[model samples]
Target chain A: MPQPDVVDDESVAAVEAGLDALDTPTERRRRFTWRRAAAVVAPPVLAIVLLIAVWQALWAAAFWPEYQLPAPAAVWQVITDNVQTGVAFDVLWNSVHRAVLGFAAGVLIGTPLGLIVAKVRIVRAAIGPLLSGLQSLPSVAWVPAAVLWFGVTPSTVYFVVLMGSVPSIANGLVAGIDQIPPILPRVGTVLGASRLGSARHILLPAALPGYLAGLKQGWAFSWRSLMAAEIIAVSPQLGKGLGAFLEEGRNLSDMPTVIAAIFLILLVGIGIELLVFRPLERSVLRARGLSGAF
Target chain B: MTATLETSAMTTAVRLTGVHKSFGAGRGAVSALEGVDLSVAPGEFVCLLGASGCGKTTLLNLVAGLDRPTAGDIALSTSRPAVMFQEAALMPWLTASRNVELALRFAGVRRTQRRERAGELLELVRLGGLGDKRPHELSGGMRQRVALARALASAVQGSQDGSPALLLMDEPFSALDAITRDVLQGELLRVWRSTNTAVLFVTHDVREAVRLGQRVVLLSSRPGRVVREWQVGDLEPSAEAAAIEEINTSLREVISSHAAA
Candidate 1:
């Protein structure tokens, strides 16, 4: 609160008046103009187009043997061939179902666990290191243990995905809660927001950016864990997933099918991130004027 | 016209006796408020002016019941005093209207009535059409206006007879540009006239304190003892603007001497 040295009264008054007059009036618009929308979406779309063109050129140039790196057309043929037979849809659905279920479980378990660890010093001290350490351990590493625990069933895949994703989601929540501005909690208390009310209105909303980040990571972990479980702990009764398709491609030496499976997995992961979590993150950060950081 | 005299006879709006607040413990202990005594009558505007570390904010907190006074008693005849911080403190997720609606909601206003009440409060602060806009969408002045509207909305819903709901402002207008601050001070006086909510404003601006408060209370730095009090009746808005200016100049001299020492 250091005050600047006083200048001539008239000059200071003029400058203050100018600053007052310069305050910008905010505009209200219901819908994004096409130009504005295009401004935002154009770059990513252009990058994707550039990428596909490069991929196609590499295939045409015969950069690698067909048995190693299949052509785009060859991968497309594998997709069309399996899709017509309905097996592609079944595998996609199976993987998506497992990922969704695992993500839900992780969120449910992790949110409360995060709140406890964040609010209580003793609980955080006891489990904080372990939670971070668990995040570092790859989801794929859990497949063997999950197979032993659940005996090569669908339950094993579910367990593996949950184990992989839960720590990240919980840790995200804790980080989000921790990062909440100290001013907000004080404001809530003064406004008569009780402990539970503060958690609901102030703590939860403030932590949302971090929590959403965790959710994005949780989904990735779930997808990775399911794929690992399907490939390593395969059971016909558990049905086919993208990992199973990749495994089948390896057995048959069909590089095109393997490439198609890999592409599908990559596409889905990116799609979920863009369509779901990205918007959520953008909205939260934008509300807080932190979108500039992005 | 004598609303202050009328209301003072009714009941004490806020009474804080021997209030003490300290942070940390043992060797690291830092006292924020030490044996402070204050009583704000209904409809009175009291400004607490001091340098940094003067515990102005700590005193405000004690009255708001946000934190307990370590050694003293605080009694509010009405519900808890509504607080306005230096920052707007509006919820970013909510629109300006919904921010006001939250206060109404907590005060037990019916859901159907909240929208109209929120709109009315917005108009009270000259932000009539900006209710749908989020905090980010508003300028700093507009955001603080919304915050003032929200605080007023709470007082309206919560205040009881005799003891008007107290509005504890912790340098709410300090961050604003001078014109906006001037406009808001005018708006606050108008609002105070209508609602009769006793205001306990904290500021380091001596002119601002003289302009806004019926009585200005000066606090010493650190443990924050009440050092002096000035009755600023002739400087009230009802007085001639020239007389108020002269009062402001003298108040600035007092503050400058304090700074020099």
Candidate 2:
């Protein structure tokens, strides 16, 4: 397309946008800008500092004794103590392994379920409301039933995690499929695409962002459910995961240790989101030009 | 070569007979097309001219196999046609090349051949060197051109017997600005001439119909049926002015009579 001598503002914007897109290299080469980096890193750091300051102030005031509300330093000391003994790392690893394994299972089970619900009208009509209803019911509700079925073993925790995440993954896929523009199917039909061919090429790719969002939510649910099962269900066979560690601290009325375990759980959840989901989302949005900038 | 061209011209690319389309049923049913009959010979350009609710789009949809007629037959000599809507329906996620390649992939073009063919088609539309850009990155006119490229790719890749393509465009350039529309129309004419594609171009614009179509078919509103038609060949500037004047008179009469009814 050539530039016309006389152009409107809208056309000018379109041309500029097109030129920007064309100029983009095959590999994205973003310059390291300190200001932009600071814009991302500042808010969370500031919030943590503020939260600690508030915790210290209340501790200093001796509000309801140190046992009930430990000082920030007390929790910090517990983290350092356990980390020095390498118990913290081991505990963290045990919990993450369960969540990741269960999340993988959720992906395997839920994806096909989502597709089936999306495409098969009869299946969707039968299972649709139940799937959503299951999502709303916290995975903790399934612990007792899972224990009765699988007993106080690692399988109980796995079962609970699967229950927690599958609905979200399936429902996410369904929503993604629903968002596909009707034109894509017509395009496929005209171009002589078989139903399966179009499903592979057009439907799946178009529904990806929504599915990614679902996967993120599914992972969160998996972690939460695993933690819940670990807290409630006692297993001599199972190692002390974060949930069990927190439970042990409560049993002993060890507030600082409990708070440290809570922090570790939060840290892992945040780490996975930052390391995995954020990058996935940013790249997707950037490719589609849905992001504010490349 | 002349014999083959002559034979192709004599062959009917599309034929719609006694096509009746009515939405809903009984008392509330709205009739769109009643007793509509039309045909396009291979290599012919026919513009369906009508007001809103005149079943021009409905008729096009019927021909494209997107929808079926309530009563009647629509026969096509060629494979399924390539349709371009009023809105350029380019997939936003794919780059310009990939969008065209998607049609090629569906047309059963091998992975090895798709890229070169896509590049060739893009070059044909004068959209060379911009294949990697996404749909939103392109201007409205450019997007429509990519859509045209996709439609062309579909036609070529389909049938595989080297059949002359059939293109059904529903007000494809109506959304564009005046200058951009003129530029695209010229490109369209060039492309059409090169491919010898049979086209059924629908538009509400009378001047546009007279300007583009080899023959303009006037369809009446409210139960659309062919009211009149005019053959317009070699629209030199002088002839274009006279054709426009005649089309305007007939168009106004159609609108006025519909309003009275």
Tell me how each candidate scores on DockQ against the true complex: 0.24, 0.33
Off by over 4 Å in 2: A1-31, B1-10
Alpha carbon deviation, residue A84, candidate 1 (Å): 1.7
Worst 10 residues of 1 chain B by lDDT: B1-10
Clashing pairs in 2: none
lDDT of 1 by residue, B78-184 (tens): 66678899999898888999889888776667988999999998977777877888887777887888899888877766664545788989999999877678667
- Model 2's interface RMSD: 7.5
- Candidate 1: which stretches are off by over 4 Å? A1-22, A25-65, A286-294, B1-10, B236-261
Model 2 local distance difference test score? 0.85
After the best TM-score superposition of candidate 1, give how far the Cα of residue A141 lies from its true spot, in angstroms: 1.3
lDDT of 1 at A286: 76
Query: TM-score for all predictions?
Result: 0.86, 0.91
State how far residue A222 of model 2 sits from its true place (Å). 1.2
- Candidate 1 lDDT tens digits, A1-294: 222233344444454345434664544444868998898899989998898789789888998887987777888899999889999899999899888988899899989998999999999999999999999999788888777787989888888898888999999999999988788888777666778888987899989988988988989998888888888977788888999989999999999999899988998899899899888888788777666765
